[model samples]
Target: MTKIGKALGVLAAAVVLPLTLSGTAYADIPFNQPINGNATYYDNSGFGACGTWVNAATEMLVAVPASYWTTPNPNNDPLCRGVSVQVSYNGRTITVPVKDKCPSCGSGHIDLSLPAFSQLADPRLGNIPLTWKFVRS
Candidate 1:
């Protein structure tokens, strides 16, 4: 092959190689399990007391109370601030995080922030009846 052709081929490989490597690296990370149960909220106390959820696209988002949101060593791990939750309603399952505290929520029910709730249920439904299981990731 001509020198110019070989040089171009090398340049293309240089750009493509790293992208290929990164894609594999990303794929190695396991996706979180689907939570299917109920949900409830509690005060964040730097003890991994936050919540996490999985969207329809399987993306996980976590939510912690504002108080614990800035505390160091919360849940003893830098990444443990978010709570993992699975919500089950009428045989359908949805998981989501508590991005913020629910000022209006009573005991045994975590109040999901508007955006988070919307992701799991229709906003027009008002409050959804669901069961959630919490876990630390």
Candidate 2:
């Protein structure tokens, strides 16, 4: 091939090769839509996985499942920004901010702060079945 033809082929391959090797990205969790899952309470002291300091007894906060934590840098995650979830259990419902990650939790599960858990059910209950959905904070 001529010099110009060789350069063009290399350029095309450089672009197309990466595109062919790239994997598709898709969301595993459905935001806004209601999700049924089990919720457990945790003490929110020190810095959370989202890199924010919170008080479990005072602030209504929740930790999303690691499977749903899309970003490597939790501080830059949009879910930890101004996003919150409305959790319903028994006859109670409460909205809480997304402030951390629950590495052991399943994709559909959530870890609520003590106060947030109390708002939905008795914190002493440890775990409770609930339905929740994302909401603007």
Candidate 3:
């Protein structure tokens, strides 16, 4: 092969490699599958990532990991489109709506509102290992 052709091939690979790798990472989120991770509580008053106001004390809600979020507008996200999650820990389980994004959470982790967290464990526990899955309502 000519030197120019080899150089062009290498350049093309360099240009496409990062995008391909990122796409692979983006596709790693298991949207409908059970996810094992830790759960933490947060004060979810005021505006949320789903572009709606929330009350931590009254509403049972959760902030899912940002890694699973792909929408340009939070309001248009699939999680915001009537998605809920059933979280289980220490024989306790509670279902909560996905109403926000947890920027600090990893792929399987979630941030639950105060009320939601209390149903699973004492708020003083702060954080706990849990398993959760998406639920349809």
Q: Sort by lDDT, best first.
A: 3, 2, 1
Residue 15 accuracy (lDDT) in model 3: 94
C-alpha-based local distance difference test score of model 1: 0.46
**Model 2 spans with C-alpha error above 4 angstroms:** 1-29
Over the stretch 1-137, how does candidate 2's per-residue lDDT look in tens digits? 99999999999999986554332112333568999999999885878877878877677899888876655677766676577889988888889888888889997799899888877777888999889888878
Which stretch of 10 consecutive residues in model 3 shows the poorest summed lDDT?
A: 22-31
Q: What local lDDT does model 3 show for residue 96?
A: 90
Candidate 3 lDDT: 0.83
Q: Write the per-residue lDDT of candidate 3 for residues 1-137, one digit (tens) a residue.
A: 99999999999999998677556544554546888899999984888888889987678999998877766677756667667888999998888998889988998789999989988899999999999988765
Question: Which prediction has the highest lDDT against the true structure?
Answer: 3
**lDDT at 47 for candidate 1?**
18
For model 2, the local distance difference test gives 0.80
Give candidate 3's error at residue 73 in angstroms: 1.0
TM-score of 2: 0.75
lDDT per residue, candidate 1, 1-137, as tens digits?
99999999999999998677555543432235433323332223331233333232223333433332333323332224344555566666556643344334443355554455556677567656665555444
